[model samples]
Target: MLAPSPLGRVLLHLSNLLVIAFLLLPIAAVTLGALQAEKTLQADTRALLPPEWTLDNFRVILSGGEQRGAIFEQVTYLPDNVKKIRFAFTNSTVIALSVTVLTLAMGALSAWTIARLRYRWTRWLVNASLLARFVPVITLMIPLYVAFRQLGLLNSVVGVIVALTGFLLPYAILILAPYFDQIPKELEDSARIDGCSRFGAFWRVSLPLAAPGLASCGALVFIISWNELLIPLILVNKAEFMTVPVVINSLVGDVHVFFNLMMAICLLALLPSVILVLLLQKFVVAGLQVGGLKG
Candidate 1:
């Protein structure tokens, strides 16, 4: 490939800057909003910045809504939603992590079989996963809610993890299988000729080579499970079982909306997934590129 001309490089840089600005605009607004007091937020509709800055919103949420150090002395009434922060955060972490682990472990094995075996049934299975991806999630809510209620899984984290894992498994397989297919079969064959069983060959040979696919799949699963709102909202009613998104939803009301508080929690909710993606971006790109190019 030839190197780009000067004008081409300038245009490329300008395009990148515009894309970055577009993506960061909402995030910047949320971060700034979270740093200001509620009165300041309401006072200025057109102001580019807050009239006065305060970390009290974050302090209240992180402190479980307790007044501290006389700064929050005037804040007499803390909402029940604020008190649920710790529980909601813990629940979100547990559920997201559980779903990612479950999806990765189960999906990898299934994808491996489908990719390597090349049988008629395996193709059907991949096709079914593709079909599952196309199904509208809202369509399943009613039936899922009824089933969870019957199974006594309505307020349990285990139930949420199971549901998310099932939904995300298809995506994981779609990402992983193609990359697995790209692996040279001669590696596994050599291992097998050396008396390693098929599963052993997979364990020792294929798994290591497929690390990029696994990393990408796990990150995608984690992000999807963490951001998922519909199923959790339908199934979980109690504050004890609520995740971050549901708790955030509860903050919305006709009487009053805590925009600053909501923004603070949202920023908190976004951090883990963002950090995971940044840390594993290389693997994610590698996996996607390989998967797309290969069978």
Candidate 2:
């Protein structure tokens, strides 16, 4: 392997620094906003450093019930529900994990068949999934709303989960199919030669080696489902079913919009996705590299 010249190395380091700064800059701003005194934020040109540190904003929002002031209130107009961040957090976790697991199970099986089975329809199915993934969720919002309303799925956690799964499944199938295709065919063929059944070969051999792809698909689903706002906003009207994004969005309408508290909730809403990426990042990188290189 040939090493890059000195100038190439400098350029590579510069490119990495630029990407890192781009990612961290917004997070740093949000953190500083969360910590600043409410008074300082209200002033013109918000400063990076807080004039005073106070937990009062977080305190007020957490404890104020329907009485708290924040920007999210404009969307939902519920002051009492903000007090139950614990419940919102729980609901978000349940929905996200459930969607991730369901998507992976269905997507993996389908992708495996599409990759290994020699059928003309398999190519069409893969193309169909690609098309579905590109369709904007916003375009389906009104129709989905009416359908869910008729089915009594509106204003329910189950409704949100179903809707999100529908939106995420296509992307999962698209990503995983290519990864499955990249796996060495000889491995499965050898297992079959030993008298193993097709399903047995898949379960015992191929599935284990597809972990990186599975992890990547699962992580993407979790992040998107956790951060989704529009589906939850339309499907669930009750405060009790509200997810974190919906809850955080409901903070806008109070007499005073508590910037500090809003920023704090925003930060909290980001934690699960952050931890997920950190833990599964290796798999994600490997999967992307393999899929990209092959496809």
Candidate 3:
């Protein structure tokens, strides 16, 4: 590769800075909105910054809508879902984790079979997964809702987990199969010779060797499941089972909006996934770079 000329290099740097600002502008606006009072936000849309900032938005939410202080006392018309932030958070966590675990286990087992068996049908299965990936999720929404309702799974976290797992499982198999195909068969052969059955060989040998791929798959699945809105919205009408996205939607109103509180809740909703990605950053990079599973 050749280095750019001086003028070209300057243009590249300027373009990069512009892209960064473009991406970060909404986040900066949200942070600023979360910090200042809603009245101040409304009064000064043209202001670069708020004249006065307050922590009352965070306090009101964290207190479970019980402590609005004298200044915010008139803000008593909170919705039921807004008051149940903690419950919605719990529901989101449980559904995401459950989906991740189920998808990984089933996907790894299927990937191992498809990779090792290498039969004509296995190849067909891989092709089917590719086909499934191209199918629009919204296309399946109505059928899934009716099926779940018939199966007595509606209005439950388990139903959401099952639905998400089914949709996400194909991607998991797609990721893991190529990685598994790359692993030398000698290791599994040695395990079998030592009296390990097929499941034993996979559980003890292949799984550990594919840790990076598994970590990547798990993170992807969990993040998708955590933020899923359509499936949850379709399956659950009860407030008790609402996830963060559904709860957030409930807070929006045509009139008398609370921008600061909304921004604060949005920030809170983003924390878990952000933290999870940061904690598993190394695994994700290693898996994507070396797993050779892009196919």
Candidate 4:
């Protein structure tokens, strides 16, 4: 195909810039908001820049509300959840990591089976997994809530991890199966001929070859689990067990909303996922490209 004309190239560049700006707008708002006091934020509703900036919001959050800086000197109260920010962070980290590990382990096995076995039932299973994605998660919340309550799993990190793992498993399978399918069967056969068992062939040869796909899926799973609100919100009500998203949600009170503090928390919550994606950028891109193509 002929290269685009100069004008067409310019238009494409402009379009790309617009889309990037659209995506970055929220981050900009959050960063700006996080750097200022609530008063400054409210003082100039129309102003793009805050008249003054402060790190007190982060200080208070990081200190677990023990140190009230100049901005919060006169404030009589802070949200309980804001004070427990560390717990939220800990819970979120634990849940996300656990879910990623579990999803990768189980998803790798299932996807490899589905890809290599090519049985009629495996095709049906793939269709079922796809169908699971179509069902709104909200619809399943009630039943899940009831079931977890019966099992005494409510108000626990394990419950949230379980729920998120099941919810995200289908995505892992779908993303990973293509990678496994594209792997040459000869490699596994060679491993088996070298005295490796069927499972040993997978463990030693196929799984290592699917590293890029695993990285991509793990990053996606971690981000999803880290940002998940509904599962934790529905399953866990205790403050100590709450994740970052749940704590962030708690910032909005019935009487007053802590917009500045909330923005600071949002920035903090976004850091892990952003860092993970950046670190795995190459693997993720390569994995996505390979997974999208048919062998």
Best by lDDT: 4
- Structural similarity to truth (TM-score) of each candidate: 0.90, 0.83, 0.91, 0.92
Model 4 lDDT tens row, 161-264: 88999988887888899889989999999988999998999999999999978998887788778888888999988889999999877766635646888889
Question: What order do candidates take by lDDT, descending?
Answer: 4, 3, 1, 2
Error of 4 at 259 (Å): 1.2
Error of 3 at 52 (Å): 1.7
Task: List the candidate 4 regions with Cα displacement exceeding 4 Å.
Answer: 1-10, 285-295
Worst 10 residues of 2 by lDDT: 286-295
Tens-place lDDT per residue, model 3, 55-166, is 8888887887888864478875877777778889899999999999999999999999999988999889888887887777788889988898898888998888888898
Clashing pairs counted in every model: 0, 17, 0, 0
Per-residue CA lDDT of candidate 2, range 1-295, in tens? Answer: 6897999999989999999999999899778877666667777464557666665556555664544344333444436667777678889999999999988988888899999995889888888887886677788889999998899888788888888888887778788898889899999999999999999888899999998789888877788889989889888877789999988778766665566677878888898898887898886666556433212
Worst 10 residues of 3 by lDDT: 286-295
Q: What is the C-alpha lDDT of each candidate?
A: 0.84, 0.79, 0.84, 0.87
Order of all candidates by TM-score, from best down to worst? 4, 3, 1, 2
Q: Identify the candidate with maximal TM-score.
A: 4
**Per-residue C-alpha lDDT of model 1 across residues 208-261, encoded as one tens digit per residue:** 999878988887778778888998999899999999989888877725546887
Candidate 3: C-alpha lDDT: 0.84
